[model samples]
Target: MTAVPEERVDRFATARQIADAVLLEGYVLYPYRASAAKNRLRWQFGVLVPPGYGRDAAEHSHQRTECLMEPRRGDRLAVELRFLHARRRTVQRAVGSRAFETVEELALADRVLVPWDEGVEERIELTFPVDELAAGEVVRAVRLAAGEEQETVQEDGRPVGRLLRRHEQVDAVLRLSVQEVPGPYGTLRLTAVVENTSDWRPPAGAGRDAALARSLVSAHLLLGLERGRFLSATDPPEWAREAAAECRNEHTWPVLAGGDGRADVLLSSPIILEDHPQVAPESPGELYDATEIDEILALRTAALTDREKREARGTDPRAGAVIDLADSMPPEVLERLHGAVRALRDVTGAPADPADGQPWWDPGGDPGVDPDRDRVQVGEHSVGAGSRVLLKPGRRRTDAQDLFLHGRTALVEAVLHDVDGSVHLAVTIEGDPGADLWRAQGRFRYFQPDEVEPLEEP
Candidate 1:
């Protein structure tokens, strides 16, 4: 057999090609959102085929194949929707009147666009016959209502009365069909139409390309980080954090200011609260974009060879995917963690009854009490839902190298206690199927609720 190619060879080209490929597998469409105002209208559509194309593949499997579309204020509107299957020959319609709340509902009956992946360019003529005189007029009127004005000079040399011109809405009936065709480069198609129900010539020079350009630019700029579905901003990657930091200098700090000591506060500048969400962009459209970058990274990372992994271990060791650390450790272990976290999330909310209040569960009173309740603060580090921490043997055991006994890390999944106050934890660990791998169990104790102490690995 022929030798395989080196993983690091053409890394940049490979990444870019893969990125383009990923871009193709997904699409971005500007579906019409019906205007709340009568006669208000905006419409456009575009499709991109991600790098990989397959009948059985899931659209969501590769995060790169995601798209986002949102309407801006104006008579203009934009709505984004995802299409899983694009290769098959199909025609879908969307329609709407004044009563419809969204332009998407209208596209269901009035507009139809085809999606393709081939690099070849194609177009079709859509014949929307408005046989009835009044209905056709109404259609033309609606189309024109969404139009703007243009000025023209009269032959007499004086400026003529400016005419109300409909923006060249690409009222093309047929669109680029790339789904079935394969090409050298990936495929991107933008289709628009201004069908006339009335006996009037379709608006002249209405360009869908301009609108598509605006949509694309807005998509890239407005949705820089709001792309991944599984993406989170509470604790984002370094790149995202840096990008968001550019927006403002203020940072969040949890504070306890009152002399009475009962009042505690988690405070941040308003800018942080408002802009932090942009980093993750939890909406479907933004999530898809973030996921796309992640998917491309995963693909490129997967392409790494054993040698490459070993060599790169010094600088860029892979995170090896997120481990549900809580699931691996025992139930009793989880109980302790949960109780710790629950106590933390509710620290300030605890009732005023000193006997039943803040340090009630502290057992050791103020000296051992931790006022913060959102996360388990151990010394300098904090633990929470998404925290990834390593558990090592404490006090009773000794070993030069920490053993990967469970083939993974011990995560704090939850903390629990019985009616008798005997604490138990529900822990999560990675199970090894080959070795008949299963969850491991262990117990933990927090000498003081406020102070972070290393657990004795059992």
Candidate 2:
């Protein structure tokens, strides 16, 4: 996840923190009520619906991740496939001494019941020697046992309704294999593939709800190495760039993780991430809604009326947890969640303290940099704002639309530097009616230094 491994063990707690965040992402949203429309449309990330079920191209029945790793003799790799199993909770009202009739809601003296979908965490771990994966493909069977449970709903100790909860038997397959290829240097490139092969089919004209019942929700893999190191697939070194590019990943994204930048662990996630991403330290536990900030949601949730709070608590146990967390969190904790900063540095590239100088985000942090007067050297000529250039659209760096700009003249609007130290020239098409407007709005097409040809002065 060598590049990402087995379900998370204690050693991978850091990665597990992020993994848990991903697992519960969007499990529930703000208002946290069953009646809320947003609460019903859930499970957005890493959901693999039953094989061939939905028309949405973005949602798939299976996914694969390919990454590069370097293994030594006797290297052992571990992989943990993590996902959520969805269970249906039906609220039933007692009609007879031994029988109950299904109902929409059940009211008791202390609590209210609403029918909702609940998630059960599922993890399957497999460990193997690197040679074993490379010599022959490894396929592990994934199964979530089908089960049912009944929770008696009582008002003052008298049975009023029953909560019937059950989950479908879901089956899936995890395949791990590898290919050996030569790297840009004398080193070797070990490309690994992780895939999902499930054997579930939806009945005639089934909807997403039906397919999702037997699907793997928020599925991801955590990878670890005992005697090997993994390389960054997204930003490989100059030597391994070509080899890394050769890896074809589908739907899934993998990134280096854990241990002070050591490549021993990788997280192959359905969501895109930079290498070594972590859950924010300021985060106050799971909100189930990743899109919104914790502090804001905390305040809003704490503000809900007593009646609204009751409904939220009854919606799902998770929402109840969120409510409890928000209501009981200390002021110090809430203050910590207000903001966070990372990679702070000045224009001189010197580390700066956020507590001291002007914020790094503000233009006054350092006066050394200015897009308006800054100039970049291109082919013996100094180019800056107002300079002219012809779009060359280099084969290596050009996008699909870049081809249409081929041979077109453009006016440089700014010379920008990215965090990665790459220089890009922002420009607008020459003589376009809206060029001035776009320039005023600071919106323009960007191209690398190599993708443009300097236009000689007339």
Candidate 3:
């Protein structure tokens, strides 16, 4: 039996990776986001050229430089390199370490702190494409000077959560400009801007502003930072939830039913409240009070059950309450209807009389009242129950008077035809200019007295 001796072996490659083979031209630069305009740490980068590089590559070179973005914890950092000619812009070749590894792998690789030299003034000017500069988004360029080591190398070989440490401040003056841009949805546009002349400082928490500013210049800068994350758009994401609850409480009774030409508007793509018909009372007054409108729009969107919305064929009684059909009714009318129903309920505190013979206050009245009770009294109003009150057409509502006299439009706006051929309807109308001259409409229906049923609360 022979005893084997224990030995440790480590693998190493003498050949340089293709990415490392590419020479660092001169300097690197990083731009700060436009939102952080007041900060002094806009542009920061370093310059490192290959040992034997000359001026030839700068003037007559086939090389183009590009900035690469990789995701990190909460933000993304700028990376630089030579661009390779490709069929498409996205297919352009990666520069530096990116050439040898996938973006994910490169981001996860061990981080090396960029070294800096303070004695030499490392400054480089960069020009951005005119189209890329806008108001909402700003870009700044940092000048990286060529020099000696700025910071010590990481003692631990492995990459950690916080990779780079700041060493020194590298400030550069910047000139910035911005332009407005149309956004993805509509006439709404965002701004994009480009800035130069920055007083470069290190990122927050970095030990040395100058050293960190210089260290920020490597080809693989921002390697430890996060990718493009949209934080502004989703501020306090839970606010959406709170908004939903408030809408439900406000719109509980006589929920808005759709109107004619309203189906397409309600079901339209993007569902912008501004483009739709003015449906709420607050609308046609203030442009910004779209909260209720948005909530109603959402309810209608969720209520879309039928693939083909039932359009106005003849005169369907339930059509007035239909979600899709309610679009045509002006928001003011709907708001009034809601208010009327709520007011009636509060005033009466009891049910109105039914059209058919039955006790109006009795929930257990005649059988004509619908058991399902999708229809309920907001106050003391009832459609099936006939009202003793006579609603005459108003003086200002010549149209209503004409309709009533001519029998053109029904006095009652909404109706229901029961299985036994009984009719009941609810009504609303544009009021007169004054209270005395106000035009009014009410819900009406004809039902067999023998077949009348008690209406229950929905």
TM-score for all models, in order of appearance: 0.18, 0.73, 0.15
Rank order by lDDT, top first? 2, 3, 1
In order of listing, the candidates' clash counts read 80, 17, 70
Model 2 C-alpha lDDT per residue in residues 1-458, reported as the tens digit of each score: 22433333544777877888878888889989898989778898888876666577777777787778887778888787889998999999998777899988876543467899899998777778887887877777776778999998877778877999999888788878877767533333443343335466667887777777888899888888786778898788887788888777777788888767778888888888889987787888889887788889899999998777788888888888888998899999999988878788446765466668544443444476688788988878888988999988887767888888889999998888764567889999997899989978989999987888889763
RMSD of 1: 26.8
Residue 246 Cα positional deviation in candidate 3, in Å, after optimal superposition: 19
Candidate 1: tens digits of C-alpha lDDT, residues 1-458: 12222321222222222222223222321111112121122111122212121222221111111111111112111111111111111222222321211111111121212221111111111222112211222112121122343333132454322222232222211111102112222211111112112222213563332232112110100111111111122442443443222221111211111112211111111111321211212111211122244333333444555433322221111111211121133445333423222234554553446555443454323333222223455556555433334444333342434333312444444344332444322334424242222223333222222222324322
Candidate 1: residue 367 Cα off by (Å)? 13
What TM-score does candidate 3 reach?
A: 0.15
- Better-scoring candidate (TM-score), 1 or 2: 2
State the displacement of the C-alpha of residue 289, model 2, in Å, after optimal TM-score superposition: 1.2
lDDT of 3 by residue, 225-278 (tens): 112311111121342333222221110011111222121101111111221233
What are the Cα lDDT values of the candidates?
0.24, 0.80, 0.25
Residue 188 miss distance in model 3 (angstroms): 15
lDDT of 3: 0.25
**lDDT at 266 for candidate 3?**
12
In model 1, where do residues sit more than 4 Å from their true spots? 1-289, 292-436, 441-458
